[model samples]
Target: MIIQKVSDAVSIKRSVESGTEEQRSVVKAIIDDVRTRGDEAVKEYTEKFDRTSLSSYLVSAEEVEEAYERVDAELVDIIREAAANIQSFHEKQLHNSWMTTEKNGTILGQKITPLDSVGVYVPGGLAAYPSSVLMNVLPAKVAGVERIVMVSPPGQNGKLPAAVLVAAKEAGVKEIYKVGGAQAIAALAYGTDTIKPVDKIVGPGNIYVALAKREVFGDVDIDMIAGPSEIAILADSTARANEVAADLLSQAEHDERACSVLVTTSETLAEEVASEVLRQLEELPRKEIASKSIQDFGAIYVANSMDEAINTINQLAPEHLEIIVENAMGYIGQIKHAGAIFIGRFSPEPVGDYFAGPNHVLPTNGTARFSSPLNVEDFQKKSSLIVYSEQALRENKDKIAAFARLEGLEAHARAVEERFKS
Candidate 1:
């Protein structure tokens, strides 16, 4: 990892990627084909990309049970516990539909309603992200979204991972499809012969999948276009070098474009963490990938003071941030950005990623400046509730008409005034 002065944050601003023209053209063609030919197009693309052929895409209950058998019983138990934790956390975020009556007899409030349906696309390739299954599905379940459908690319053998199946079963997902890539996104956005279109789509995928999500966004809601994973650790001299290095590497192993950076007040700690990162990178299973990530995007900044370090972090607006300073809790109010904040050394980024109960689906790039993590609210719609008494409407009708007229909406003004005329 290279060391730099904190003023050099320009180099660390961001590197969000948009798909190439070729990729976008490919995604558009697939989405159009899926819209035109439906299930047939999905299967054709699945065979081309995943090298698997299937008469049916839905995973059967029998196959789910078989998946449980293939996966270790102990891991299944862990998935259940993780699901429970996620459910419990999101349940706290749930708000009921409410209405309130004022002294004037006007009833007003907001109605909270879950989406009619949702589709979650899980990427399948070098690894199985059962955690993603739990993360995406459990929140929708907690928000009371019905018909949560899951789709993942099947292996060359035409099977989703046992752990993924087990996780979905545990998360209460009834519909699982063996389709992925841009085609799956298309099927989810527009109804296919087999897959019903959903109100919203959420999950992470490759550039093709990301582009597909972007293309279909106006028709159906989507989670943000997730860029590579990012972790920014703000440490002080009190922070342990090895632990900081390890936490940074955790995100690096996710992708070659993943970013890991450390901003610290202590010069010695900066040098030590830089050394520790390289030393630990040698031991990672995804060393080649992590090494490249660290080499290309990782850095250490020696700030003149802790305040400078914190300011630099806010400017970056990282997706995941860890404050390992001496008085970490005291700095919470000062943090203006970050999708998720891990305070102190005890709470590593992975804790929130898996067992800790926060959604791992977060805004990437500098979007944390204005966006948020996936939550129960994302799966629910808010409708303004109004039960206007005749007296209340009578009092406000003129003002409402005048306001509408000010906007040059004559019909809107008449709509409000008509209630009062004669």
Candidate 2:
């Protein structure tokens, strides 16, 4: 069972901020090795870590076609529908190249351009999920990224999962490699003979992948250092105990470190939900993982009032938040921090995770306080546009020079003054 005391909030926050020194050292070594050795390092690491050897790293066209044949026709249709929903939602986030001219002939705006290419790292092992393929690839595709390079570890059979390959093909991924872990990230950051360097890398992975992303951030942009999945439900007396318990378990099953929190004003509801979570855990296939997550990081806060519950939610700043109280929409304005807010009991987190049209690749580990979910903006680069007419330049040159000189850069001041010379 989860902790009941309010002070457990501190423990929850601490649990999310985890990265050992040994993990960093190992990831750094892998990154440096890949930087120097290129495909050779990648190959060696793939054999050592993934326990699969291959003559070639690239997934062939025949393999992709076979994947389509292998997966069930019904699931294929559902993936296509999910792809359509994702594309529709992300298209709305697309930004147009905009500019404006002032009366003084100064043109200022932003030019939004999509990155040339992006590498998506889909975790293999027990964490492989086809939904991640759709979430990472669709946004880049919608933003007009020309090339989408996908990398995932081969299973024991030396092949990518059929469902994952089918999803990548459905999402318009043109290039794919059967390699994973930190080595794939390094190859993406610094080009290998087989895998060309990409402008940015996106998707979720294990700790090694997360650390590798952190290490190579300066070389190539990354989506975010995503943490374990978490959910915080702010329910009141009206909320159903079983539904809330099931929702909490939804995220808890993601990993042993995943967190599930419930903040409610009703003590009786808390007791009911706690009992339901234990009862339901027995039937889940991933009960061992979920149980460990609950015992370590899960919690329920018995707030005295709705105000206290809102405070608790903001303090936690959970990745996925469910507000099941009365007039859920009415409390939306009051919620200050959360990656995604599921407003009613009917709107569970899975709805957002799958066919709900919103991007499910969200900020985790309380990053919702400042960052945002992955959207079209993540794939697009913005440049400030400034064009000053001769008159405008003449009017502002002295002021610009004065400001530059104040910063002890005489060359900057002189450059502006030289432009006005006779």
Candidate 3:
């Protein structure tokens, strides 16, 4: 990892803008093909990319039942435990439609309605993540989504992973599909003859999936435009170098493009953490991926003061921010933007990724400044409710008509006027 002083803003921008031209063109072509060809296109891509031919996209109930038996009993129990925690956390976010009426018969309030149907895309290949199944589906279920459709790429042998099936069953998914990648996203967004269209789609995938989701945003609501996973650790003199290095590597191992950064006031701590990262990298199974991630995207920014370190973190808007300083709580208010904040030495990013109740599907790149983690609210919509009595309309009609006419909307003025004519 490169160590740099926190004074060069131009270098920071260049370092972070890692997007490529090829990614854009590939995603555009896939999206267009899926939009035009629908189910046939999805199947072709599935066969070509995943190397699996499917007569049907939907995973059968028997497959799910068999998956339950194939998975170890102990692991199934653990999935159940994790599912319970996820369900409990999201239940707290449940909201009811409400209205307030006055004596004058004016009713005004907001109505919260769950989406009719939702689709979740789970990546396959080496990036099969069952934890994503729990994070995406449980919230939709809690929000009372009528139908929950899941899509994942099949392995070379043409079967869904047992763990993925088990998690889907535990989270109460309505259906599961074997199709994956941008084609799967298209099948969910535009709806083929086989797959029903969904109101919203959520979950994470590779660049193709991300770009497909971005392209399909207007057709169906999506969770967010997620980028590669990233972590930024804010450590101080009190933080253990080994612990900080391990946490950084946890996200780094995700992909070659994933970013792992450390910001600290202590130069000694930074040097020690860098050395520890090198030592640990040699033992990791995905060391090649982690090494490239650290060598290219990773950095240790040496700030002159703790306040400067906090400011630098805000600017980066990392997906995960760990404050391993002496008084982690004291610096909580200083953090303005982060998908999730882990405080103190013991809290690592992986805890939230797997066992923690909070959703792990977080905003990546620099999107944490505006986007948020996936939750029940993402599966719900709010509609404004307004009921005006004849008398209420009579009282406000002139004002409403005048405002509309001022805006050059004569039809709006006439509509308001006609309401009170009788």
Candidate 4:
């Protein structure tokens, strides 16, 4: 990893943008195939990529039961514990539609309604993540979403992961599908004969899935386009270099593209953390991938002060941020952008990923500046209510008419005028 002093590093623009031409073209192709070929296209893509053949895309009830038996009882208990925490946290975000009536017999209020149905995509290849299922489905359930449809790729045996199935059952998912990749996204967006169309889609997948979601966006709502996982650590002289190295490696192990950065004021701490990372990397199971990531996108910066470190962090807007300083609380309000903040050494990023009650699905690649972590609001819509009694309309008609006329919208003025013609 390259080490730079805060003053010497150049200000670089973010890597991801709205949509590149190649991305648009890929998305368009996926959308077109799904639109025209439908189920056939989905099946072909599944066979080609997932290496599994499925007679039916939907997972059967018997399959879910079998999955429970296949998984360890101990892991099942852990999943339930995690689900409860995730549910409790999201339940707090649930909003009720409310209204207020005036003496003039006019009522005005906003209505909060959950989407009728939503599709969640779970990546299923190489590794299975039951934690992702909990993070994605719990919020939708808290928002009272009517139907939760889950889609994941099948293994070589042409079956879903037992842990994934167990998590889905615990999360109250209505349906599970044995499909994955961009094809699964297409099936959800345009609706295969088997998989019903959804109002919105959530969860994470590979580049193909991301591109597919980008393709199907207008037809159905989607969570933010996730980039590679990233984490930034802001540590001081007092911080534990070993712990900082471990946290950085946790994110780097995600993929070769994942970014891990450390911004610290202590040169000694920087050298210690770097040495610790090299030592720990040798012991990691995914050492090859993590090593590549650290050699590439990973960075270590020795800032002049905490303020300079914070400024560098804001510029990066990493997906996960850890503040391991003596006064971590005092710096919380100063963090302007981060997908999630872990204050102090005890609060590692994995805690939030598994059981901390906060949603783990977060914006990536500097999107934290504008977007937010996934929550109940992602599955719900709000509509404004406006009411004007005759007295109220008459009282404000001239003002409204004048405003509309001033904007060259005579028809808008006419609509209000004709309503109160006397």
TM-score of each: 0.98, 0.97, 0.95, 0.96
Alpha-carbon runs more than 4 Å astray in model 1:
none
Angstrom error of the Cα, residue 274, model 4: value is 0.8
lDDT of 2: 0.91
Candidate 1 vs candidate 2: which has greater lDDT?
Answer: 1
CA shift at 321, candidate 2, in angstroms? 0.3
Model 3 backbone overlap count: 0
Cand. 1 Cα-lDDT: 0.93
Tens digit per residue, CA lDDT, model 4, 69-166: 99999999999999999999999988789989888767799999889999999999889999999999999999989999999999989998899999
| lDDT for each residue of candidate 2 in 116-173, tens digit (9 for 90 to 100) | 9999999899655889999999999999999999999998678999999999999999
**Runs in model 4 with CA error above 4 Å?**
12-27, 101-106
Question: Can you write out model 1's per-residue Cα lDDT over 145-189, one digit (the tens) per residue?
Answer: 989999999999989999999999999999999999999999999
Rank by TM-score (best first): 1, 2, 4, 3
Q: How much is 146 displaced in model 2, in angstroms?
A: 0.9
Measured with C-alpha atoms, the lDDT of residue 10 in candidate 1 is 71
TM-score of 4: 0.96
Each model's backbone clash number = 0, 0, 0, 0
lDDT comparing candidate 3 with the true structure: 0.88
TM-score of 2: 0.97
CA lDDT, every prediction? 0.93, 0.91, 0.88, 0.90
Error of 1 at 218 (Å): 1.1
